[model samples]
Target chain A: MPQIFRRSANSYARLSLLGALLLAGGLIGLIMAIGSSSYVTRANEFIEQPIQFSHLHHVGDDGIDCRYCHTSVESSPFAGIPPTKTCMNCHSQIWATAPFLEPVRSSFRDDRPLRWIRVHDLPDFVYFNHSIHVKKGMGCETCHGRIDEMPLVLQQNSLQMQWCLECHRAPEQFVRPRSEVFTMGYRPAVPQSVLGPQLVKEYGIQSLTSCSTCHR
Target chain B: MRPNQNSQFRNSQLPRGLGRWSFGRWECAAILLCVLAAGCRQDMHDAPRYDPLEASPFFRDGRSARSLVTNTVARGGLREDDHLYQGKVDGQLTDTFPMPVTAELLARGRERFNVFCAPCHGRTGQGNGMVVQRGFRAPPSYHEQRLRNAPAGYFFDVMTNGFGAMSDYAAQVPVADRWAISAYIRALQLSQRATVDDVPVDRRPELDQAPEVRLPPGRPETPPAPEAR
Candidate 1:
């Protein structure tokens, strides 16, 4: 017998081939979308920490400086997380028995550390130093956003490689007076375009784009 | 033919009459492979390593962090100057500063004191810091006759060794910074007790006018209580 399905056979195969190619392309697109989604990138995601520490209440209303808790920001690579002792220094008197601060109390009592979940986490390969940035006149708000406004801390920036590279290429655009580095609501006295280069020269800031600056 | 054999032959071939399972084995496998590939990840986050302070079987002491070798100073950390490092000269607290008391030193001192000492000793050294307001014990005011007469070395010693109820600031503050803070305390004392004659004639006119700039951590310019009565 002659091939029963002559013309339609190859047409069906071609359609199937087209469908397979489309499916592969769609899968790749989906993967890319997922990788950059809020679920994966965690931008604007509020991580549940051990204690409900409100930057709004403490830094905003109470007018506490960021340096009070993150004491090592000026001197070390890590903006040192406040230990139980720092909390107890104040909490030992105020709100010493509040239900909300139970974890802080227990951590202090047992001399154990509260396992705060990492927010703004980059991959292990990438390195970031808070001290160098702060010393170079970048405000806490520049990278951390308006932390004073957040009741629950969230990852404000995407913290992606491109986001980092944008600032690294022209650090003058972000540089402030060294005095204003800790001021959350600081505004440049002059326009950023005028002030940035001036401050960069004054501070002798070098714009670095080397891979080892962060990736090593 | 046996029923099993008949069913097996039909299953191997494509549907003679169109029904749901028309795809071949290779087609089914391709679908499965796509599903599996979508779920694939490298598992980098779960890579084997010891976390900080983690217990380890490899170590006899069961600590991942090894203790530093005995009696060692870190590189470039040899603190040598008697006055700069110990706030002392000739094994006694010296009244004089090792470095010159410059205008820049006072500026730096003001910044450091505000961050470190002003929490307890108030911005103006009035012994009424925010911590004191919140119930921490108030320290002696710098303007007090006793503290006013205190040599710069006295303040440095108190900061380095700590006074009653105050813990040593040796960890929080560097040795040179302690001297800066002491010098700032002297300036604060002078400010509280300054005579009108202390203002230089050329610059005195600016003092009469309300301060245009907010001076850091000192007396706020009070508008001369508009012609009292």
Candidate 2:
């Protein structure tokens, strides 16, 4: 009777071990399906913009002032998108016939504002004041990642807080002023004439490595 | 040095345990997420406090503060000729008069005008004042048809309530002083339109003398074409 009981106990132990192995294997397969080797589709996968404004055009051709398009940058916290009226002031005579410009023309006719979809998004906790940056000489290009070259206005940088603070901590390594900020390659402009050092002198921006600075 | 058999098993066990952790990655992650979820506790009842005294003048009515100063200066002014809209309250603590526009009060008015109005409206009451030199577009000339034709009471309204871009002087300039400024502005309009017949015979001589700008004439090298361009 004892020998028979031991044989039965051993069989039961084997079945339990096999059950455990199967559960573990199933869990591993689930993890691999959801988490293992995560992939990111390239920014090229998406294309949904109203006007399809070529950043390459204005920033390259007309030499229009950045402030002319983004007038509120020096005054408001936002680097404000220009109003429809602002576009109509010039486009009423220039590109009055373009199909993409219909939305802009409609807004002007309706006396309504344009609801532009923001291409880049940042967490709300980050308090970024464009006025101080613009006033102190931070350029459009330093953080925007060669925007003048993009056809459909894809976000060049991740714009994650860490990415911002990395430059904010060591601005001399990354930041450049108006003309230089928009450049595609490493801008070898003079140091004091550039934005990174001038902002330090003008406003004395403290180290951004601290969480309190951006988080607040 | 070669380890004993028991010690070798122990060493192998250590490696195997570490391997087990990596092999069972979902278990490790699930435990980590559970721990993180347990740690997150928030209390959301704390509210920030603010003091009313620290509120800006725009929020707190600043007119009351200016009225305090106005009451003290209101005693000596043109006691008549001002049809001020006073329902019952007479410039915060005084009841004797709403605004006194006496000759003595007009002198104070002239003094206050030079202090405030002359910067925007010239000493001669033309809108081409010193502020216009500082790149501010001058207001239309006070003697212009529109402003000249405007009522005396309407001029007082502008000083008290302020026209566009100009901040209301109701807080800075006293109400009686505002009346004084209106009287002086009217005096200017009358001066421009006053004829010899309009002026009393005794005061006609001075009123007839046309004012002239004294400029150092540059004797131009060749000066025959005298038709004013």
Q: Residue B147 of model 1: what lDDT? A: 85
Estimate the lDDT of model 1.
0.79
**Candidate with maximal lDDT:** 1
In terms of TM-score, which candidate is strongest?
1
Highest DockQ scorer: 1
After aligning candidate 1 to the native by TM-score, how far in Å is the CA of B183 from where it should be? 1.9
How many Å off is the CA of A99 in candidate 1? 6.5
Report the C-alpha lDDT of model 2 over B40-140, residue by residue, as the tens digit: 53222112321211222453342111224544545555445335632123333222333555777667667557656776577778876655554455677
Which ranges of candidate 2 are over 4 A from the true structure? A1-47, A177-186, A191-203, B1-229
What is every candidate's C-alpha DockQ against the true complex, given to 2 decimals?
0.14, 0.03
Model 1: residue B146 alpha-carbon error in angstroms:
2.4
lDDT for A128 in candidate 2 is 74
| Model 2, position B98: C-alpha lDDT score | 39
